[model samples]
Target: MDLREESLYLAPLYSRFPLTIVRGEGVYVFDERGNRYLDFASGIAVNSLGYAHPKIVDAVTSQVKKLTHISNLYYTEPQIELAKRLVRLSGLDKVFFCNSGTEAVEAGLKFSRRWGKERGKYRFISTVNSFHGRTMGSLSVTGQRKYQEPFEPLVDGVTFIEFNDGAALEEELKKGDYCAVILEPIQGEGGINPARREFIETARYLCDKYDALLLFDEVQAGIGRTGTMFAFQHFGVKPDMVALAKGLGGGLPIGATIINNRVAETLHYGDHASTFGGNPLVTAVANVVLEEVESLLPHIRKVGDFLGNLLRERIAPLDDVLEIRGIGLMYGIDVKSNARNICERCIKEGLLVITCGKNTVRIVPPLIIGEQEIKEGVYILEKVLKEGSG
Candidate 1:
């Protein structure tokens, strides 16, 4: 179908770019007309290893041939392996897999509620400007009111605390009425804001003091995007629960809520479940993706750091650029100019980037991207900025 026809048929939920990406490899994606563009957003940080990695393709093909899927009622080797690897890597005791970041978050929410009910507590505290997911339950705790305005009277007992504000967090926790406190170590959709070190440490301390579970939603910043397998590792502040997705499945769709032993055991048999949650096909591919990335984690960390530094050096000096805040591969450039216009200019210059928050341009290239691609994209961005300024 033609572009216009396709647009007419689809919902207007997303403001799509003018170009249609037909194919991708490494850090480059090609339009339908074969115009190659350097991919800096990595499909919003979903493609961890870039497009068409040989290992991923091979695993998916082999798994498809062996077993596509079966009921979760029975055991599946791939699911078992993926769960084991995740638990091992995360130092978490149990794992429950689902289809997307939102589902993973929903699962975490359920666990938190159950963790509270089993102990007789039932409120949750989330930070302002935090973005969890779009589902009703996850959306309730999401810090942004714009998303919740349409759907009023969301899950009750959700209090909003200021992000990176230790004093406010301390005040809220002192109330001693919250069952869980969930926040992203690095807020993704609310702009690339990193949690203050003191705030994170304080959150941990307060959660302990109040017997509330501290949940980290690392869906966008997890699975090697932040140099470490998980962002919480960098802070040395382990959360009671973590919601993971995005890069976890490479190109495939997968999500998981990892929990500590003591906390995880709160859920009973029928507390929560999903048919495709632990299916063999998705898990098979996720297992391969995890193993491949785990083996190349050191390389990912090195390249991510190099890219972040390059961005800081190149864009941080611009008069219109306000700040560069992020770690490893997930960095955002706070621009004084229109971030949407800059994103369009980047697309025109053969580099694909996206905007986040109000005035920040987010950069999240695939972990396998090399220094050459990084330099090339940055060069394009710099040229665009110079011309845009003029």
Candidate 2:
């Protein structure tokens, strides 16, 4: 069967680009027709190490030969090892693994509810423009009306405040009705806005005072994308819990909700479970991914600075550029025109980027992306922005 024709059988959930990527190799992907495109999108920030890293390839090959998968019913060495690594990296007590970022957010929400059950706190506070996940539980907390309006009467009691509004957060928390305050340290889909340090500090203090858990949804900004191992680290405040996915398993599928000892104690046996979560295959790959990311932190910082400088020097000066927002390898170019159109032009120019929010072009290159790739991607972006402005 022709792969292009077979794609029609799949659900039309995504407004996919008309590009058939057959394979990838180190910050670039090749189409079925052998056209190459520099990949700054990094599969929406999931490909931490870029495409076809030798170590990742070897790990997958070796693990597949030994064991591909087994249910969470029994002990698995890879799963246990990966949990340990995540716990260490996140500075959390325990971890609950799942299949994707949505699952991680779902689990974190449930854990928050469980923690507050005795206190009769079932409500949650989230911020505007934040995109949590598409799942019912995650969607309910997400503050975008366009996404939530269609799925009417969603899991209720989720209140939205302005992003980076400490006063608003405190006012709601002061009501003493919330189980948790969930936020993204750097809002990914909400135009790559980073939370203010004062804002997060306020949330931490208020959550402690109001007896609510502070949940940081680091799904899109974690795992070395922010130069730090986790985005929250940059703010100098630790969260009660963190939801991670995107870059955690490199290119593989995995998500983890990590909680501190206080939250972990609230969850008992059978309180939550996933049949395929923590399976050997993905966890094994995650272990390698984590180790590799840890080693690349310094490199990420270096290249992230380089990329940031390139953006400011090149793209920011363009007439259509509204603002440049982001940290580390994750940046967004807020333009005067449509972001999707800019991204399509970039794709045509043999560069791959994506959009966040309505007018922001999102650039989340691989952690392993280099100076040369940074220059190349920015060149395409600058060219596109200049043309659009003209």
Candidate 3:
């Protein structure tokens, strides 16, 4: 139960919550003391199945018993099937697998740069306060000064501009030198900011006009998080290339870069490779995740709307709660003060929550969570906001 070992052995990179969660099921996770807390964070949207779901467990168990991994030199059915499912879901042509979100972003950048190789185009444009990933290349496109300043001398030729600012984006695109325009359909880390429909439409237009690729970084907001297969579906817009992770593997480590024919046609053998990517275990579980997510989509849409309405009617009236904004289940409560303390205190009150941007409480529960859990999470959040306890 003691976190002494973790403190002694692990790197100090993560600012962890105090509880040592040992097990989870449905929408509740238990600490070492066996205290069950409602989990609204869903491992920051990674546990799409809400923990220990029979389908994911069965697929993984059967897969490990059969084969755990095989290199890219050979073919595997799990890999092929998952790729097919993702391609079919996003209307993308092919998929490249990797270990995490940042890797997928890196692969996307490479694919874009390669597609524009003959044209001598290598520049990228991303939005301010946007979060792609932490690796050097993805970090280069990330607009947060805090994350980029430390890792100076990143992959060059990336421009950071304002989110939902279409005219500025158009000005940059008019140069016709960018390889790709990478965007998060909904900026999750930057406080649940959804891209304006007009902005995205402008991006598609400019990318077409400039012969550049439009890439979507759906790392946090994809895979039914927004009550759809992808958030781009919400705006009825499509990106040529999409990078996905977080919820793709149902709690397993996996990342996928799905691209249409424009980018795929240019990627020759050995242009990019991942040793353990698309291995049997993770992909098999991911297949199950896709199946489950398909079934849960309608339920997600209905319940997420109910939950959003509940928050609007209840939490939005509070003096400290400024606004409730988001799509589907990926909502955030913009607090006037002390959002981080509210998250930590929510853990103490038998609930789990996390923060994004500066003062927004991110509420991305599992796609399978029902209405009752939403009320409970908000109840705890309201209590925390009232108390403002750290």
- Give the top-scoring candidate (lDDT): 2
TM-score of 2: 0.98
In model 2, the runs with Cα more than 4 Å from the true position are 1-7
**What shift in Å separates residue 149 of candidate 1 from its native position after superposition?**
1.3
In terms of lDDT, the poorest run of 10 residues in model 3 is 381-390
Two-way lDDT contest, 1 vs 3, winner:
3
Looking at model 3, residue 354 earns an lDDT score of 89
1-390: candidate 2 lDDT, tens digit per residue: 265764578875677777889899999999998999999999999999999999899889989998887788789999999989988888889999999999999999999999999998999999999999999999999988989998888998999999989888888988888999999999999899988989988889899999999999999999999999999999889899999998998989999999999999999999999998888888989999989999999999999999999899998889999899999999998899988888899989999999988689999998998899899989988888899889
Error of 1 at 112 (Å): 0.8
Q: What TM-score does candidate 1 reach?
A: 0.97
RMSD (CA, Å), each prediction: 1.2, 1.3, 1.3
lDDT scores for all predictions?
Answer: 0.88, 0.92, 0.90
lDDT of 3 by residue, 1-390 (tens): 567887788998888878789999888999888999998898998998898998888898898899998788899999999999998999989999999999999999999899988988989999999999999999999999999998899889999889988889889988888999999999999899888899899889888987889999999999999999999998888899999999999899999999999889998988999999999899999999999998899999998998889888878888888888899989888998878878888888999888998689999898999888888888887777767623
Candidate 2: residue pairs that collide:
none
